[model samples]
Target: MKIFIAGAGAMGSRFGFMLHQAGNEVSLIDGWQDHINAIIENGLEVNYNGQEFNIQIPIYNQKDLDINSKAELIIVFTKAMQLDEMMKDLQPIISKETKILCLLNGLGHEDVIDKYLPAENIYLGNTVWTAGMTGPGKVKLFGTGALELQNIVPGFEKEANEIAEALSSAGLNAKYSDDIKFSVYQKACVNGTMNGLCTLLDGNMNEVGATSTSKTMIWKIMEEFRAVADFENINLDLDYIYDKILEFNDINKLGNHYPSMYQDLIINHRKTEIDYINGAISRKGTKYGIPTPYCDFLTDLIHAKEDLLDAK
Candidate 1:
């Protein structure tokens, strides 16, 4: 398969290398000039399962993307805020038969993609793999995880299955789900509880999970999320989710891992996906006349921090 990855950050680079190593043609499309240049010069460095290696794959910044290159699949890993711009920039590469998979962290992203490309070409999904970008052309894979995806448009299941199969063959642990929205909600709950707390405290996953205060905050956040999920008719059991999180913490799957939102804040990036995570719950609360004070308060605090950073 000819694949074009649309972010080329940690997640994108990790997937790109895996697919490339599996004997598939993969190219990266990203806006990070330094990262792209470094990859073109020295290949992409991937640290996986305690081993580090480099894989040579074609990478292009938005400016240098070849208009005529036909990609069978385009996996979008860009930040949520960049969706519109990326869709416009990638217009030339999207064909009618091409499948676009959004493995991003958020809700309501499918609507954005449908605005640019045909609905039939879009797929919605979520991933649990933890990865971090250390430097230009370098990505560290902290844990092996799974992917759950589903067809957003009618009559697209076969195509979605084919892509999932290819990703699985590349050792990505991809699975197809009839209830994609549930998968997305589950991931959002995890992110909403973990990412914001970690960013605010300037701590890694294990550090946050080990503290009493952090554990309390996580439960509070999850409670709010559970309330909002109930209002929205999304099937999620707070007790079950919390049990799973504790399991993850105990195994150190997230050991020494800094949340992606924290990394974005430290680097002075333009946006974080918090609005999609906690903010989404707050919005749903407003719509349903349900109270999510904890989530609302945290979302407001994070937005204020973001605003302060923007001013500087």
Candidate 2:
């Protein structure tokens, strides 16, 4: 498959490396000039599963990508706030036959994608795979993860399955989902609880989880998410989601790492996707006549932090 990855951050770069190593024609598009320059100068510096390799995959700044270039599959890893801008910039490569898969963290992304592409062309999914950057053009990818995805349009199972197979060929552990919306909400709960709290507290998973009040506080947040999700007819298993949150408390797992939001808001001084995560819950809860005090408060606090830091 001729693939293009939009965003090319930690997750995007990891996916691009894996797909390229699998012999797919992969190209990268990112707005980060330093990252673009670093890769173009020295290839992508990737440390995957304890092995290091320098693989030269074609890369471009969003504005520098040739308008005539086309892709069969375009995996979107752009931040939620930047999705619309990315969709606009990549318009020249989008076509009737192009399939777009969104692996971003949060909710209501499909609505933004819908403006640029038909329902049949949009695919939604989430992953447990993790990646991070040590510096520009350098990424550390560890552990194994699975991907779940479904096409938005009905009667597109065959095409969706084919895309899954292609991803699985690259060792992405892709699975076709019967209820992707449910999966999306499940992932959102995970992000909402961990990312929001960790960023506010300025701690990694272990530090945040070690707090005496962590469980109770996290439970309150998840309860709000569950309430809003249930109102939308998406029943979330609180126990199951809570257990997933607790897993990060173990130092041997993902405890030592800061989530993407922490990296964006604290370390990088960039704006976060709070509006898509907790903020989205707050908005939906308002629409559904449900109270989401925890989410509402967290959303407000994150925004205030952004303002205090003058985050771009």
Candidate 3:
């Protein structure tokens, strides 16, 4: 399979590395110029399951992505806020038959993707894979994870399964889902609970879980997410999602490290996906006359932190 990983951050790099190792032709496109240059020069160094290997894969920054081949699959790992800009610039490779699998985190991404691609060409999914960027071209991949994907529009179940099978060939543990909206909201709950708190408290997942007041506060946020999800006709199992977010007993899942938002904001001084995660809930809640005080508050806090970093 010919695949392109758009927005090749930590998680994106994990997928790209695995797929390239699985014998697929993979190309990476990301906004991080240094990371792109480093990968192009030294290959992508991945520490997976305690063994490290450098896999040479082609990487392209925004100004350098010249493609003559049509991508069969463009797995989007781009930030929710950057979707529009990415699509406009990615016009060169988006053929009519190209299928876009959005593995990006957060909510309301479908609407953004829909603006550029037809419903038939869009695939929606969520991944529980965890990876950390140790440097520009390197990542620490501990343990393993799974992927769940489904077609964005009805009647494309066959194609969705094909996408899953293609990813599964690369040891991605891919599975086809009947209702991807449930998975999206479920993962959003995890991000909403841990990502913001970790960023605000300057802590890792375990540290956030250790906070005595964490569970109750996280429950309130999940409840707000549940309400907003309900308004959209997506039913999320709040208790199940909450337990998954607080799964710190195992280091492989939701432990030992800061969530992506913390890495984005505090560590790298980059803006976060808060507006599409918690802020999406708040916006939808406002639209439906539902109160999402916690979501709104956290959104404000993250933006303030961004502004603070800018001032520094």
Candidate 4:
């Protein structure tokens, strides 16, 4: 399969390398000049399981893209804020038969893609793996986890299954889920609780988990998320979700890992998916006349920090 990856940052580069190593034709589309040049000149440096390996794959900045290159699949790994513009820019390369898989965090990504592409061409999914870009052409794999995906439109299961099989073959642990939206929300809850807490505390997962204050705040955030999930009619058990997060914090899975949102704040980046996670809670709470003071407060706090950083 010819796979085109947009964003080509940590997760994107990792997926590109994985697919390429599995004997699939993969091309990366990214705007980062240094990253693109480094990968083209050298190769993508992947660090995983205490080992480092390099894989040579085609990398190009958006400006140099071949408008005519046909791809069987296009996996979007861009940050949520970039989704709209990236979808618009992808018009030149997308064909009718091309399947678009979005593994981005937050809700409303499918809406953004549908605005630019046909609904039938889109596939929705979420991932639990964590990765980060250390430097140009270098992506460190913090954790290897599973991906859950499904076709939102009817009659696309065969394509979705094919994509899942290819990812599984690459050792990605990809699976198809009929309840894709709920799965996305499940991961979003984890992100909402952990990501902002890590940012506020300036600590890794283990440190945050070890702190009484952080643990309490995580429970509060989960309560707010649970309310939102209930309002949205998404069937999620609060107990199950809470236990799952606590398990993840238990000195094994993500103990030393820094949440992605925390990394974004540290890098002085202007955007975050908090708007999708906690902000989603606040929005739905308002719509349903439910009190989400915790989410509302955290949303405002992150925005205030973002504003202060921007002012400086």
lDDT (C-alpha, whole model) for all candidates: 0.84, 0.92, 0.88, 0.83
Candidate 1: where are CA atoms >4 Å away?
267-270, 310-312
**Clashing pairs in model 4, backbone N/Cα/C closer than 3 A:** none
TM-score of candidate 4 versus the correct structure, residues matched by position: 0.94
Comparing 2 and 4 on lDDT, the stronger one: 2
Q: After superposition, how far is residue 98 of candidate 3 from its true place, in Å?
A: 0.5
Candidate 2 matches the true fold with a TM-score of 0.98
Predicted candidate 2: what Cα RMSD to the true structure?
A: 1.0
lDDT of 4 at 270: 39
- lDDT over C-alpha atoms for residue 42 of model 3: 94
Q: Please, what are the lDDT tens digits per residue for candidate 2 over residues 1-312?
A: 999999999999999999999999999999999999999999999998789999998888888667566789999999999999999988889888999999999999999999998999999988988888889999999877899999999999999999999999999999999999999999999999999999999999899989999888889989999999998899999999988878866788888879999988898888999999999999999999999999999999999999999999
lDDT by residue (114-194, candidate 3, tens digit) is 888798999999998888898999998876789999998899999999999999999999999988889888998888988
Selected candidate, larger TM-score, 2 vs 4: 2
- After superposition, candidate 4 runs with Cα above 4 Å error: 268-270
Please estimate how well model 3 matches the true structure, expressed as its whole-model Cα lDDT: 0.88
- What digit string (tens of lDDT, one per residue) describes model 4 on residues 99-162? 8999998776898899877898899999987787777898888666899899989888888888
Mind sharing the TM-score for model 1? 0.94
Q: Of the candidates shown, which would achieve the greatest TM-score relative to the real structure?
A: 2
TM-scores of the candidates in the order shown: 0.94, 0.98, 0.96, 0.94
Using lDDT, rank the candidates from best to worst: 2, 3, 1, 4
- Output the number of the lDDT-best candidate: 2
**Position 167, candidate 1: lDDT:** 97
Query: lDDT tens digits, residues 1-312, model 1?
Result: 999999989888888988889999899999989998899899898888779898888888876666677779999999988888898888788888888999999778998899887888889989988788888988888667889899987787888898899999999999889989888888889889878887777777787788878768888888888788777688788888887677666635666778788888756454687788899889988998888887898888877878878822
